[model samples]
Target: DAGVTQSPTHLIKTRGQQVTLRCSPISGHKSVSWYQQVLGQGPQFIFQYYEKEERGRGNFPDRFSARQFPNYSSELNVNALLLGDSALYLCASRATGTNEKLFFGSGTQLSVL
Candidate 1:
């Protein structure tokens, strides 16, 4: 069994560009969620997808969106990035229909210049 995994451990971009982050959930998991952690702040939920549908969302702007594939992999997209968007984009997953503990990947560190 493999834990969750994310691509591009680190990323650098200038303001106003768009970026996409990827995530692959652990085996047998059906729910994937996206979170953003700014410097010195706890992770804040961005979006959650379960069974290929949006399950939950946080207080984020329309620029933030995500979707879970049938294979349980997920991608988070951010458009018109702002300096405030620079943060550790963490991807988490849990078993379906249960509040089980989430498995978090190291995350893609996005740095907006």
Candidate 2:
């Protein structure tokens, strides 16, 4: 009955470091998506995976990446971190349907200094 879960709640890093954020989707869900939310801005879609395959990617640079597991859980990886990369990383999951709404986790707050 869990909606979605994200791990490490928060992370702090220095420039040039790397960070991995994790997420587990709701039971029976097959689609997982990632988004980044910067202060004073809306969430920007980063990646979306369906059936363990890459479905969509956002305007982020190559430093951002993600993958979905066989169980529909997902991980978002950010390499060569920068201060600009600091934001709330959100994970969402939904069942297969065009009209389905995304169920989101609280998100991982990452800070780069």
Give me the runs in candidate 1 sitting further than 4 Å from their true place.
none
What's the distance in Å from true for residue 9, model 1?
Answer: 0.7
TM-score of each: 0.96, 0.97
Cα lDDT tens digits for candidate 2, 1-113: 88899999999999999999999999999999999999999999999999999998999999998998898899999999999999999999988875779999999999999
Query: By lDDT, who's the top model here?
Result: 2
All models: lDDT? 0.93, 0.94
How much lDDT does candidate 1 score? 0.93
lDDT of 1 by residue, 1-113 (tens): 88999998999999999999999999998989999999999999999898999988999999998888889999999999999999999999999777779999999999999
* Model 2 TM: 0.97
Candidate 1: residue 76 Cα off by (Å): 0.1
